[model samples]
Target: MSLDKRKQAFINLGHFLNQFNSNGIVKKENVLHNDLFFDAFKMQIKRAEEYNSWFTQNNVLFALESWTNALHHQNIYEWLKDYTIAKDSSKTIAIIMAGNIPLVGFHDFLCVAITGNKVLAKLSSNDKYFIPLIAKYLEYIEPSFKGKFMFTEEKLQDFDGVIATGSNNTARYFDYYFGKHPHIIRQSRNAVAVLDGTETHEQLEALSDDIFRYYGLGCRSISKIFVPEDYDFDKLFKAVYKHKDILKYTKYVNNYDYNKAVYLMSLFDMKENGFLMIKEDTSYASPIATLFYESYTDLEILKEKLNNDSDKIQCISTELNIADSVKLGQTQAPKLWNYADNVDTVKFLLEL
Candidate 1:
């Protein structure tokens, strides 16, 4: 199949996703296969919520909307414009997806399919519904995709390469097992924000989205902050008050209560505003309902520290003129070319 056919199939899928939202589901007359897929996709969304409590309807729609905006013809063309994809030789690429957030590994899946490779996906148990349903939609749009995609619960085999997302521990296992194949194995990494106490209230409020979205589960979510010394907490706390509604989620509230109790029992120095807690720590990964922060004496020294620990970091959010830093509120909404772990997935797939 031609790469143009594959790209058009995904653009059709994007149009299908654009019809559903939290307010209501509206079927557009122009969307392809609406008569067959409109109702089925709605049911799949409900099933996804039932399968995992973390996959709430809002979050699921958010993921869909993000992809809907991304899969336009122009966007897809621009993303692949720099790469030369070889469609003559077909290979199978196995993907081990991580389900910390909805569709966390969909980017890898898209790369594999777009680059003319068969996808052997092992879906995370927490996220079994959405991707497979989308795969079916793609098959309907372009029948050639019918046999190119496979989802399995058994051990993966008969693949030329692998892309796996897991913790630091599982990366060791992936390295040992998939060592001989061309692969990209991603480990845990967390995002951080840099604050110089010069940020506007609006900027800080937008930063709250980076912290609270997906309940801070995804690697792109901001889990830590770097602030200048003697920074006051009053403005930051007041700004994040906009997201106090997040506490209404039962699981998030439970985590807040439990972590707050533990911190109090241990007498840790921290600050809280009932919904979110900020603690001073040197760690990058923070628990649910909590954020870790560290004070930096010198901006240059802190830059050096972050550079030295780049592998442990995903993307940095800052208003300062820092190299490769994402805007304050744009960390979670990554562009098509914002490769994870600073690794080029399209280049990897082309080489395979």
Candidate 2:
């Protein structure tokens, strides 16, 4: 298919996804194939939640909603405007998806598809169903998209290029296996927030969403924070209390209870407010329901520290107007151009 045809198909798919949200799944008039798909899509959302506890309806809808906002004609054009995306000869691109959060791997798929490459995806067992259904939806919307993407349970073979997302360990394995092929293999990364004690209660509360959304499974979720030496934890605790209802999820509560017990037995110094925990830690990757924190003596020194550890960081959220700082609550709601790992997937795909 031509680039315009492929782009139009995704824009239409965005219109379809706009129907579902956290408020409620309301089918609207003039949506494509609502008679056949609206109910089916709703059922798939339920099925996604049933298959993965982290795939809560709220989280699934949020992912869909993010895509809906991104898939508009203007947004797509803006994202692709700089790129010279020619519908060249199709190459099969293999994707090893990670299922930590709902639809986490869709951007890679979208990049490959939009650039006119065929997809051979080895989906995470934890997240197996939805993308294939999306492929079907794309096929129906643009007949040319048919046969452009396919999923497989069997061992991947005969693909021209590879794009894998996994833990650092799995990434090592991917590097060994796909070393000969042109590839984009990724490792786990975490986001951190720097606090200066000047943030409003409103900003701090908004920061809670950056920390707790998707049960802290997404790479974009804030797992660590940098606070000044004299910063108070009470303000953060109070702000995060807005999400205290997260205690209702058994999976999260179990993780919270187990991690808390281990920390207590180990005599780790930490603060908790029933639902979330904040510990003085030097590390970036914290346990679920727990956030690691460190004290910064000066913004200049902290900036250097952040620069040194940039490889381990994703988006940094703060209100200090720091370099590359994402807003308090906008990390998970990334724009189309905000490539993960700071690597441009579109440029990578186009080069292949």
Candidate 3:
């Protein structure tokens, strides 16, 4: 199939996703294949939380909304214009996706589809449902996509390259198994924010979205923050207080109760606003419901420190001059070109 054909398939999928939003899932008139897919997708969105307690309806809607925005005609064209593909390149690329968030692996799938390469995906059990349905939808839209991608539960085989996302522990096994093939193996990395005690309440509130969205399961979620010595915790607490409703989710509250008890038992100093907690620590990846914080005396020195530890960091949220820094609220809503872990999947596929 032509690249334009596949692009149109995804554009149609975007229009399908556009119908389901937080406001309401109002079926649109122009979305292709809606007669068959519209109701099924709406049911999937509503049932996501049942399959995975973390996949609340709101989170699923957010993911759909984000993808709806990303798969626009102009956005897809702009993102692909800079790359040159072999046109005839059709290697089967193996994708091992992490299930930390809804459709977390779709970006890799998009890169493979856009590059005209076949995708052999090993779906994460936590996120298995939506992608297959999406694949079926695409096949109906562009029949050529039918056999270009396949999902499997057994071991992966007959693939030219691999892209795997997992924790640091699983990455070791990925290296052991897929070491010979060209691969992009991603490990657990958390985002962090830098605070200079001058950020407006609006910025801090935006930062809260980065921290709390998706229940802080994504690698791009802000798990830690770097603040000046005299930074007021009250400011952050007040800003993020808007998301206290997250405590209504039983899983999150259970984690909150458990992690807080452990912290108190260990004699660690921390503060909480009944929903979220901030603790002074140097670690980049914090537990659920807790945001680790560190105080720095010198901004440049801290920047240097974080830079030296780049592999453990995903994206920094700040107004400061830090490398790979994103705006306070923009971490989760990354552009399609904002490659994960700074690895360009499209470039990898083109070379393969």
User: Which residues of candidate 2, in runs, are more than 4 Å off?
Assistant: none
Model 2 lDDT tens row, 1-352: 7889989999999999999977779989998877877888899898887798789999999988989998989999999999998874568999999999988999999999999999899999888887888888999998888788889899889998999999999999999999899988899899999999999999999999999999998999999999999898999998998898998899999999999999999999999998898999888999999999999898999999999999899889999979988889888888889998989999998887
Give lDDT: candidate 1, residue 25: 73
Clash count list over all predictions = 0, 0, 0
lDDT of 3: 0.91
* lDDT score for candidate 1 against the true structure: 0.91
In model 3, residue pairs whose N, Cα or C atoms come closer than 3 Å (at least 3 residues apart or on different chains), thus clashing, are none
Residue 172 shift from truth in candidate 3, angstroms: 0.4
For residue 255, model 2's alpha carbon misses the true position, in angstroms, by 0.6
lDDT accuracy of residue 255 in candidate 2 = 95
Question: lDDT at 272 for candidate 2?
Answer: 94
Model 3, span 266-333: residue lDDT tens: 99999999989899998889999999999999998998999889999988999887776888998988
CA lDDT, candidate 3, residue 172: 100
Model 2, position 109, has a per-residue lDDT of 92
Question: Which portions of model 3 miss their true places by more than 4 Å?
Answer: none
Query: Tens-digit lDDT track for model 1 on 1-352?
Result: 8888988988888889899765667788978888888999888877776899888888888888888888878899999898887663478999999999999989999999998899999999989877888888899999989898899999999999999999999999999999899999999999999999999999998899899989999999999999999998889999999998887799999999999999999999999999999999999999999999999999999999999999999999999988999989989888889999999998988877
